[model samples]
Each structure stands twice: as structure tokens, then as C-alpha cells.
Target: MSLIAWAIGLALLLIFIFALLSPFEALGWWAGWGKRGLEPSPPSDEEMAEAQETVAPYYIVYLTAIGGVSAEDISKRERVFLARLKEALPDAMIVTDVFPFSVTNNPLNGERLLGWLWRRIHQSRMKRSLKGTLFGSLIFLRNLLQVAVSADPRYGPINNVGVANEIAKSLVRHGYPLGSGAPIVVMGWSGGGQIAVGVARYLNQGLNAPVYVVSIGGVLTDDPAVAYVRRLLHIQGSKDKFPSIGDILYPGRWRIVPHSAWNRALAAGKIITVDPGPMIHTGRGDYFDYRATLANGQTHVERIVELIADFIRPIQDVAQPA
Candidate 1:
């Protein structure tokens, strides 16, 4: 055989091996590989300013979706929602970008890819295995390269730990009474919701502080850390189908026989589900557009913020002194 033929055969063989190993890779992430970490840094000046305005009875740390890297990337609609949330909860500081650092520079961040593929599979109405296979392959390639470079896996529980540490340091720096039993709300949208669960678990274990998690259109998978949260509020739009993809991929949340972890959380009153009838997965039309509002009295964004404010007030009130 010619050299080119040998190279082609080798490439095909690798592809076949990758396909066979893909599912195992996806499962392995949850089982083990998604546990690497990076060192945490003190909250930056901007982060401090964002969270310092009012030392409210409750501290809210808002984690954005997968592509939301910085506050500057937040859209006008989102800004409006944030402003309304601030007005309604004047005593609280709604901190965004709680995790300011990206785990790896790899364009193929596995967690983000999982979210994207899950959404696509759902939107296309394809079978769940399609998402599993594609996500498995993507994660395999991503981790394979990371291992090749002797670098840590960028998207995993360890990233959650780093972000949680930063949040803890910020609360301490701002004098938020970490172990004083103050209410800590970790709110996340899309993939951030998964991170929120990890952060909640970290705070509960490391600081022994109770945490409340609010997931808005979030894609979630089973994580042992979820049990650490005192309460979980899941807000989903009736029209939004993307967030449910996690349930399909992982067989929890919406399953007929819910996963044991989720079932236990629900039974223990650690989970609450809310469906806002008029909302969609993202901005105005498609995902991430954020240009227009739904026809309801308020935009979907506004409504979500309003709902969050309403749900958190009682918790905050209970924490406040008479």
C-alpha cells in the first residue's frame, strides 16, 4: 500500500475507535473526569462594586448562560431585568459574573458543547442518543487534547470549586456574614445552573452555609452536590424546551421514574418547579437574541426577575431581624 493509503486507513480506524468510546467518555465525565480544578483569585474591583451596593439581608449571585463571559456582554433586555430586580429587592445586591474566569481556552469546552448539542437535539426533535453521542465525542476530543497537553479538564466540578471559593471570598470581603445563617441565593441561567448546583454544594460543605438555587431555563445533569442546597427553584417557560434537554439526556427532572438523586431532593422539599406559561428559551426569538419582550404585560425577562424577587423575599424576610 502507498503511504497515503496507510494514512487514510489509520484515520478511519481512529474515527471508529472514537465512536465506540464516545458514550463511555460522556458517562465517565460524570463518574470521574469532571473533577479537576484551578486556583481561585480574589474578586476583582468590578465584581466587588457589583456586589457592594447594598448589604441586603440576602446575597444573590447570578451566573449567566454558557457564552456569557462578561457583564459587558449582557444585553439591554437583560439589563432591564436586572434593574427591575434591583428595584424590587432594594436591600439585596444581585452579583453577576460570579465566575469571571474560563477553565480552558479550548474552543471545544465540553460542558458548553453538551448544552449546545442537547438544545439542538431537542429543537430538532431528535432522539436523546443523538445528543449523547455527539456530546460524548466532543468531550472525548476535548479531554484527549487536555491530557495530551498535561492541562486540567476545563469544565467540571473543580471549576465549580474555584468559582465557589471566589464567591466565598467576595462575601467575606464584603462582610456578608458567611456562617451567620444569612440566605445565599445562587441563581443561574442555562449551563450556569449546573455550576450553581456545584457552587451550592461547595458552600454547604466547605463553609457550612445553606444555599438556595434558582435555575432559569437551565440545563442540568445529576450531581451529588445538588443535595447540599437547602432549596431549589426551577423556573421554566412553557414555550422553552431547551432546559428540559438535561432531563432527557440524564433521565431525571422530567422522567417518569426520576433519578434517585433528584427524587430524594424532591421528597426532602429541596426542589420546587415553576412554569411561567408565556416564556421561551431565550431572548426575543431565538436563543441569546435578547432583543424583544413577549406580549405579556412584561417581557419574559422582566417576568422571570419578578418571579425571582417574589420567591426570595420570604426567604430574605425570615433572615432579617424584626
Candidate 2:
């Protein structure tokens, strides 16, 4: 090969290697990506019959957190409010124990030199100093080279929207196939909020039924996807950090307040905002306390449950002649 051709080939090879080593491919999974393996078996036949008969016109969806916490971790704290919800709406079909989606982990292949070169080209940027710049760049390049040899195909592109659609379809197939006639309320915390927003947006196109979505400490953003959930009731607490208001990339690097700004926008709307009191701030852990009511005359947890009920309440109430 000509010297020029060799250099061009080498540069391309390096870019490809870097792409392979880039940990950004792991973006799809995030913290809560593969938390749940698969959908649990549906309630028994008798339970289904009972659910159909007793469950109200509303569907209750509980979205799990993506911080690697188990569903049990969620239920332990939120059970008080969930139990109250169950009691208030006896026939309501409540579905918890479902995860966001399955993430196929695709590690880089480390067999070929060209592959290694490809991986090095795709890594994060670095500085200009000997230690801070060159050293870091070389380390990143080396890591990319290692990963390029054995790349996994599964991590190519994640269909988060598709996962949300599947969850919606499951709700229809198992519970109310006819949605407009019934109401559906979805509540998710953290990353679960992202998936819940996707499900409601996709389903809302077909079924105009009142779809109420309440996200606690959810990672809400101003992206096109989140715009659909704008009409859905969204609640954000004041203190919880982590996934606070939009993409929080590089902690302490440059704080971008997308989620916080979104909350500000909602505050100007007709949606009811509930403060979950000061317990541990973020909606993570067992902070779903129903008793902590803010001065706004509403308890964060209880108000959430009540919102679900009120949202599903028939539209003919006030219209009825007194």
C-alpha cells in the first residue's frame, strides 16, 4: 500500500477502534436497564376474572426505579400508598413488578489490530497536558483497541420506545383491550418515568381515554419524546439530585438543569404539583410516605394516590344538575 494510503487506513482504523471502546454504547441500559428479567406470570385465572369484575375503569401502573434497586425495595416503602390505592379503587387493575426493558450487553471484540484501532477512535475527549491530556488520550485509545477485537452486536441500538409499547400492549392484552372506555393512570419513579412516558404517549394516539401519568423524581427532559407527557400530571420534589431535571452528565463538571426547568414550566400550568415533603428528598428508597403533607393541603404520597382517583373520576360529575 502507498504511504498516504497506509496513513489514511491507519486513521480510519483508529476511529473504528475508539467507537468500539466507547462506554457510551452502554447508554441504553443506564442504571435501571436490566433490573427486571421478564414479565412475571399473570394473576391466576380466578384472579383475572376477579380483576375484570372488580377492577375499576382505571389501570394503575407502578414503574420501578433504575438505580439497580429491586421491585421489593420499591414496594416496602410505597406499599402504604399502594395499599390505600387498592382500597379506594377496589376494581382497579394495578400492575407493578414490571421493569423498564432488557438490555443486551455487547462487549467489544479484542482479536484484531484493525478492530483495536477502530475502538480507540470512538472514546471520550481529553485535555492537552502530558498527564491530563496525552496520557488520558493514550489510555482511552488503548482501552478502545482492546474492546475493538470482540464487539457485541446486542448493544448497537436500543429501542426504549419499543419497550414502552410492549408494556402498553401487555396491559391491553391482559386487562382492558378496549382502552377509550376505561382510564389508565401510570406512576413511575426515576428511569421508570421515562418508560411510563413512552407507553402513555404511544397508547394515547389510539385511545383518548384520560391517561394520567405521575412521575416521582423521574428523569424528565425537554426532548421531543417528553413533550407528549407534558399534559400528564408530573410531580418533582425539590431536593433529590441524581436524575434531576434533564440529562445530568459529568457530575460536578457542568451542571445542566433541564429537569429543573421542566418543573418550572409545569408549575405555570393547570397540573397539580405535590411536594413529597422533606423525607430523603429524591423519590428513591422507601420515601413514598402518604402522611407527609405539604402546606398546600396535600400529602405528597396521599395526594398522588388521590390524583390517580380524581383523574379517573368520570367527567359527568360536575355536569350533573345539583
Candidate 3:
């Protein structure tokens, strides 16, 4: 074989090896071997009491991209998007924590082993070092594997529950009305889309509340969580093609498979798809780029934030306190 062919083959082999080893972290967490985050816990008495009182109009838990290292480690565009979203929905509680890739919600640079390496990679990324992108791929691939675990029937149940616990804890921590039948909208970007949908079933029952999922170019599997989600809005851009990877990888997402959960949700009108003009998955002209201007004269992030805010806005008065 040619030298280039040999190199390509080696790369594929390494990726396969990485995939094979990806589930160990989550497995260790479940087996009580990892020390980053605790197992799922029920709501406290105080949290239950807080659930009864009046709360924010609605909740929005924003899940970051797979490139994310920690809850707080987000891109400048993402931070700007969250800030803009908060301004757009001042009455709604917007949550930016809850590392979507970790079943225990443990960040890459958290208490887990090999954290020092991840910390350095995160720092390098902040400095915009080329080496950061090189090292960040490892984190990206790690989270990507977790996404696959969430979609795999063999591991999804155990994994999804752990992630759901994290989301539940975040909501309760932020004073979400648990038993109040209030609504939560999970705005998941990229890989987070799958996670946002994956945890819907548990979140729905855990808090006795409704859950909505808004996927911004999310890679989703045909998990049963789709059935439990109150509503799912899949917003994609015409120029983006990465989202199609999910469709290609998961047979259940294929149109020919009429019986899959994703298809069923589509048939029942539980899933809504929107294409907000031209954009790509990431980088220069990606959806959240602050400098990427659309034909309508709106920045990429502005248009998307508006769409998200309008979709989840409530009818009742959602004004701020005096």
C-alpha cells in the first residue's frame, strides 16, 4: 500500500481504539470507582418546598458543544449567545452549567484522572494556540463517545439517568419549581442535542415537570426519550452538513425506518424542524459566529437567539420585579 494509505489506515485504527475505550469512564462512575461526581440523588426537602412557590416563567438549560471541556469553558461565541439569550428572555432562568458529555457531569479538567492534561489543553485553547486544537480533539472525541453511549441501547439507560441527575440537580440548585409542572427547555447545541433529548424521559419523571428540547444541529439517536419530550425543535442551517452524520450513523433516524422513535415523533408532530437561512456547523461562519452576517443583516447568533426566544416564550406576563 502507499505511504498515505498506511497513514490513513493507522489513523482509523486509533479512532476505533479510542471508541472502544470511551465507555470506561462512565462505566467506572456507575461502578463507584470514579471520584468526580456523585451518583444521582433525589430532591431535598428544601428543594421540594421551593418548587411550590412561584418561580421563573420557564427554564432554559443550555448545553454546550462537544468541544467544551467544562461547564464554564465555552467559546466566545457561545458566551455571547448565552448573554444575548439572557437579555432576550430576562424573566426566564438560563442555565449554562451541567457538562453534557459527562454522565456524572464531571468536566474534563475536574477531579478525574488525567485531569492535568485536560487542564493544559483547556488553557491552551483559551490562548488560541494551535496546539490547543490538536489537544482539544482528544476532548472532543471523548465527549463524542459519550454521546454515542447515550444513544446506544446497551448503555443509554444507565448513562442517560446519570446525565438527567446532573440536569435535575442544576435546576433544583437554580430554584426550578420541581413539582410545579413548570416547563424546561433544553437548548442543546451540536452534540448536546442528543444529550438534551436523551435525558428528557428521566427529567420529565424526576421533577414531575414537562421538558422541551431544542436541538441546534444536534446529532441524535433513536432513543425512547423522544417519546417523553413535550416538544422538540430541530433547527438546522442549509449550509450545515455535520448534523447529517447522525442520520447516517443511526439507522433508526433514516426515513425508510418508519417505526423508529425519531420517526414516530415526526409522525406525531412532536418534532419540528426549522432551517434559519445559510450557515455551517462550526468555525468562521458557523451558527454562533458573532461576525458572520446573514443576508437579512442579522449576525448568525442574533438570528438564532431570536428564534429560540420566540419559540419558548410564554403567554403570561413575564416581567421583572420592581
Candidate 4:
């Protein structure tokens, strides 16, 4: 064989091997390999003492989207939304401890590598036009693989269990005992909304406490957990395409014949859906953007925060001072 032919054959073989092994590597990372350091540790004595002293009427657990936890990881809209939430509920303690389930921080993970490559390619000015088409394709493939692997019954349960336990531990570490009767609110964005539902269920079943869930432009599936939640508020942007992906990826969410658990929940008023028109999937178009005007002559951020405060105030025994 010619030297060029041998080189070509060897390159093809290596590519094939990588393609096969990449999924396994991604799956392994999802299964919690090399991620221990990122996990939240138990709160210290001082932290627990502080928590006990300033225990608020409600606890707000904020779960970020893919690759989002810190301010740097999130967009300006998310940061603003969080700030407004805190401002609106002065008595509630906001917990930003939940980590992203996917392999976002790990530089060595195969999924992260793929994401890095895609970002690099999409960012180049030469490929600006191609970026939208190619990047969307890459994202679709990534989301599909993630749903196929991580959304399954076997592997998916582990993530919820871990997150639930972390939440419980965090409560205990912060001096909130199990079954403390303190109301817990979970706010999840994008994919984190799925995790919030799972965590709510676990908290209800395992800890004997129900939690209020707020899904902001998040994709959701029907889970028995909805039965155990105190209330579920799903805020979807009219222009947001990300949340609709759940319908495509998980058809059961939209099925009418054999009503999915989510459908049933909606029917029973256990879940409430809010459509804030003209909002996009991310950034300034989300619920947080002060620039986005609402029909009521208030900014989108202002109106949404008002809605949230109204929803939460009635649930709490001690209301915030007007």
C-alpha cells in the first residue's frame, strides 16, 4: 500500500475508536467520576450556628442551567433574576449550592472537550454564519445523547438521589433538622429544573417535607414527585425555544391519550404555567431582563418578581412587611 493510503486508514481507525469511546467517557463523568471536589461539603460549626440564628421563613434553593452556578457561569439575566428574587423576598434565605449535573467544570472530560471545540469553532468570525447552523446541530446531538443516557431510570435516579441528599445535608449542616416544617422553595433554570423536580420528590418522600418548585424556562418531565410538591410554578418565555425541547425529547410530556404525570398535575392545578410574552430563551429575553417591557408598563424583571413574591407570601405564615 502507498504511504498516504496507510496514513489515511490509520486516521480513520483512530477516529472510529474515539467515537466509540467518547460516549463511555461522558457516561462515566455523569456517573460521578472525578467530581468529588465539586460536591458541596457539610457546613462547619460556625456556618450551622449562623444558619440557626438567622433561619428565615423560607429557604430558596437556586439551581442553575448547564454550566451555570457561579455568577461568571451564568448570563446577566440570570444574575439579575437572582438579585431581584433576593430583593423581593427579604426574609427568605437563598441557597445557591446545587452544582450542574453535567460535566461542565472538568477540563479533562470528553463532553467538556467537545463543548470547548464547538465553542471555539462557533466563536470565530470566519465561521459566524456557519456557527448558528453547526452549533445548533452540535447542541441537539449533545442534548439528545444526554437525555438518552442521563434521563434513563437506572442512571438518572442516582443524580436526583445525590442532589436530594446534598440538599438534606445542607439543611442539617445549616442547622435545619429533618422534618423541620420550614418551607423550602426550589428554583431551577433550564435543565436544572428537571433536577429540582427530582429533588422535591426526594425531599417529600425521604425527608417527609414538601417543597415548592419554580421552573424558569426549564424543560420538565412528568414524575410522581409532582404529587408531593406543595405547588409548581413553570415560567416559560413565549420566544424561548429551550423549554420546548422537552416536548420533542420526551414525547410523553405532551401526550394527550394516556395523560402523562405532568399533564395530570396541570389538570389538578398542582402545576401552574405562566407565559410572559416576547421573552427569548436566554440572556436579556428571560424573566430577569430589566430592559424587556411587559404589558403592565413594568419591566419583565419587575413584574415576574412581583408574581413570585405574591406566590410565596401566601404560603408563608409570617408575611413580609408591605
Candidate 5:
């Protein structure tokens, strides 16, 4: 075989192996792997502004997109978008340090053995190389598997609760008073959506708080946790077909499945679907792209922040979890 063919075959083999092992970290974490350092490292000075706790009407714990290297190493567009979100909702406390991709909250880009590989591929992606786009997809694929695990009936309970506890700890670190029953809104971007829904019940149970979810271009599973969610706001762009895949592949998301968590939420009016209009899942024209301007002169991020900020502001509910 030619060198190109050998390379292609090797890549295919690696991907197969990667997929097989994708669930290892989550499963291991639940099985007590890496239990010692579950708490995330202390934030740097740059992150302290959003890391500290404060008395606010709402506590927003953000889950970065699957492409994240770490909670702190999100995309420039995401960084700008999040900063803009904090500015838009000064009354809300935003905790951006929770890395939901790992049940133990360990970043893929941190001190792990594969951290260097992730960094190299991530940098290639930053340079917009074809090689980067191809290899960087491994990050997306791995995180997507974690989302599936969170939706899987067999593992969802154990893993989601573990992740929820990790998130609760992060919230406490950020100054959240556990058992305060302060409303907790999880803002999930991209693959973060299913994760947000997957962990809602546990977050509510752990913190005794009213748990809400706000998903932007998130591919959500019809996880049973949706049944316990206080409310959900799914923000999808009109042109983004990525989210539709969740419905296409997950039978629970189908209409005929009347008792599915998704349908139940809809029947009970607990889910709100909003079309931000003319947005893609990611990249140049996606929701967080500050360069994409509408005829009204607002960037796509600005427009989305305006919509989400409005819904979040008047939420002063003090309901505790059952």
C-alpha cells in the first residue's frame, strides 16, 4: 500500500480505538479513578473576576462546548461571548470553571498523558489547517461520547450524579451557598446541552436549588433528567442543523414517544424552544461569532445575549428541589 493509504488506515484504526475507550474516563471516575484530585485547580488571576462567589439572584454555571481544552481554555469567540453575557446580566453569578467533559473535572489539556497531543491538534485547529479540522474532530467525538453516556440509561445515573457533584463543588468554590436553594441556571453550549440536561436532577438534589437549563446550539439527548428539570430554554439558530441530529438519532426525542422525557417536558410546558434566526452551529457564522452582523448592526453574540439576558433577569424563583 502507498504511504497515504497506510496513513489513512492508521487514522481509521486510531479512531476506532479512541471511540472504544472514550467512555473510560467517565466510567473510571465513577469507579473511583482519579478520586484524589477531583477538585479543579485554583483559578489564575485572569479568571478570578468570574471565579469568585457573590450574592446574586441567579447562579449560572457554564459548560464549555465539547471543543474545550479546559474550562479556562475556551475559544476566543466563547470567551468574548461569555464576557459579554456577564456584562449583560450583572445581577447573575457566572461560574465558568466547571469542565463537564470529565466526571472528575480534569481538563483534557491539563497534566494528562495525552495533553500534549490535544494541545497540538488544538493549535492546528486555531491555525485553521485541514489537518487540524480533521484531527480536532477527535475532541468533539470524545466529548460527544460522554454526552451519550450521560444519556445512557445504564450509566447516566452514576456518571451524571458524579459530574453534578463536581459541579456543585465548583459552585461552592465560587461562593455558592449549598442548600441555599438559589436558582441555578446551567448554560450549555454545543455538546454541553445534553450534559446540562443530564446533570440537572443531581444538581437540584445536591444543592437543593431550582435547576434550569439554557442551551445554545446544543445537541441534547432525551435524558430522563429532563423530567426533573425546573425549566429548559433551547436556543437554536434557524440554519443550524447540528441540533436536529439529536432528534433524528434519539428515539425519545421523536413525537410519537409521548412519554419520553423530552415530550413530557414539552407537554408540561417546561421546555422553551427559541429560534435565534440564521445562525450555524459553530465557526464564522455561528452564534458566538462577534463578526457576524445582522442588518440591525448587532453581532450574533450581541443578539443572542440580549435574548437570553431578558429571560434570565426576571427569574427570582425561590423553589427548592423536592
Candidate 6:
């Protein structure tokens, strides 16, 4: 065979092997590869200033969990948690918006040749044994490719920790520190909690403010991406199995173990753990409701509110002149 024909055959063989191991559908869903709508820009300067004045003492940037699509898509439990936040922090301003960060809705479409190959990979069980070996290799390759193409995963489930810092810079440009030098609270439930970790990392890198982070049920890990966000607080219920088990999220790995370790390391520093008591073993999506129960059931929201209030008061008190 000619050198050109041999090269062509070799290329085809490699592609066939890859398809057997990892299908495009699974790869796309996991990595969030390809195009997605851009995130909406931050509130305008005028709107931001108004929000600053209205949301004095604190400004909150809330990111939703995986596949959230928009803030309106948040679960009933989250709505409940936000309601509690509104009542508890009457003086603070809360800006809630949903961000689109994943590309799972559409099927994969590459070059026509690759597309047909992908279809075959999806259709064949004969490829199973080959798939078992290729699966791991393909996933690693795809993940690397996706990360190389975008700072955040193409899946758009978790907040892109890197992009989240840009949002914070925008906040600062719009005078977020305010005259009070008030603290900024970057809050998220599940996927959003991952963004909160990103935000803390962002702050630690350049902009340092008294930002108190709260992850309802975020995956915690020892990865360097989360190293800077040391000042974090995580709340998980006893019943929520999610805190212990990983999800089929964009990044694949969950943040629970990292959170547990973080809590242990910070045990001597500023970490504080708050348990909402037994409810169900759902996950962070259930935080708002579980917390709602704590708020209105027996202890009432005030008790928990007070705990948060106490956590934040010291900063405000320290800012005040004697």
C-alpha cells in the first residue's frame, strides 16, 4: 500500500477504536462540549448602583445548580430558601439570576463523517468490549479537549469558577465594596456552590473582601481550583445522600469529600458547620425546603438567621468607628 493509503487506514482505525470506547452523546453530556449561549452581562452600572444602595451591607451573587437553565428553573426548595433570606436579611440586597452554562440539549454534530461514526458508536453493543477499554481513555481525552477549549466545561452544569471571578471584577468596577466596605456573600445551592468556591478563589487571587461563602450541598474536593476559597461554609443534611455520593455532573466528581476535608482543615480557623436536622436524603436541591422546615417548623428561621447574623456581625462591628 502507498504511504498515503496506509496513513488513511491508520487514522480510520484510531477513530473506530475511539468510537467503540466513548460515544459522542455520553461525551457531550459529560463535558458540555461545543457552543452555548453566552452568559447575560451583569446588571448595568445604573442598575448596579441602585442595587448597591438598596442592597447595602451586603450584595449576593447566586449561581444555580446543574442544568438550572435559569433562576426561574430553581427547585421549590431554593425558592423557599431565598424567601427566608429576604426576610432574614431585610436590609441587604439580593440579586438572583439564572445563568446558562451547559450544552446538553442538542445532539452532537461534527463533520458528516464523524457524525455517522458517532451514530454507530451509539447503536452498537458489539463494540462493548472495545468500549470498556476506550471508555476511560476517551473520557480523559474529551475532558482535556473540553477544558482546553473553554475555561469552564461545555456541559454548563457548574458555574465556571474562572468566569465567576470576572463577574466579581465587574461588581468591583461598579463600586461593590461601597462606603461600608461591607462584605460580599457569594451563595449557591448545588452547582451554584461550586461557583461560590470559584468566587472565593477569585477573591483570594486579586480582590480580597470579607466574602462569606455558603454551599448548601456542593461537592468539595482538594483540587487546586478550590484552594483559595478557604473561607467557606457548607451545610448538608443528614438525610441528603448527595452530600456523600457523587452526581453525573459536568465535572463528573462531586465536591462533598473536599468540603468535609476543608471543614476539618479549617476546624481551627473559621469553619462552622450547621446541620438542619433530619429530613430526607435528597441533596442540595432540597436545602431550601429543609432549611424552610428549620425556619418555620420548630426552631423557626430566626434561630438560624441569628446564627448567620452572628457570623456576619463581627465584620460589620469591626468596620464601625468606636
Per-candidate total of colliding backbone pairs = 1, 33, 0, 0, 1, 16
Model 6: weakest 10-residue lDDT segment is 100-109
For model 2, state the Cα shift of residue 49 in Å.
Answer: 12
Q: Candidate 5: list runs displaced more than 4 Å.
A: 1-8, 35-53, 317-322
| 1-322: candidate 1 lDDT, tens digit per residue | 9999997898678766754543433334334554433334444455555554335577788766654434345555566766778888888767764542333221232255455653443334324376555544433343332221111223445555556776776675555654566778888776667767767877777666669998887766666567788888998877788776767755555547555577779888888888865567664643223444666645565667777988888888787731
Candidate with more favorable, higher TM-score: 2 or 3? 3
Please state the error at residue 173 of candidate 2 in Å. 4.9
Per-residue CA lDDT of model 4 for 56-149, tens digit only, reads 6667787776534231345567677779988988877777655535433232222453656645543442254765554444433443343333
**Candidate with more favorable, higher lDDT: 1 or 4:** 4
Name the TM-score of candidate 3: 0.90
CA RMSD of each candidate after superposition: 9.4, 13.3, 3.2, 6.5, 4.2, 11.6
TM-score per prediction, in order, is 0.65, 0.52, 0.90, 0.71, 0.89, 0.54
lDDT of 3 at 231: 84
Q: Report the number of the highest-TM-score candidate.
A: 3
**Model 3 lDDT per residue over 103-135, tens place:** 877888988777898998888877777877766
Residue 239 of model 3 has an lDDT of 92
Worst 10 residues of 5 by lDDT: 36-45
lDDT for each candidate structure? 0.61, 0.48, 0.83, 0.64, 0.82, 0.48
| Candidate 2 weakest lDDT stretch, 10 residues | 144-153
lDDT leader: 3
Q: What's model 4's lDDT at 169?
A: 60
Worst 10 residues of 3 by lDDT: 313-322
Cα lDDT tens digits, model 5, 1-322, are 8999998898889878877887777677656575444333333344445545455666888998888878988888998988999998776778888898887777887777688988888888888888889888888877877887777888888778767877877776676655578898998998898889988998887667889999999898878899878889999999899999899989999999999989989999999999887999988999998999887888999988988887787674443221
**Rank by TM-score (best first):** 3, 5, 4, 1, 6, 2
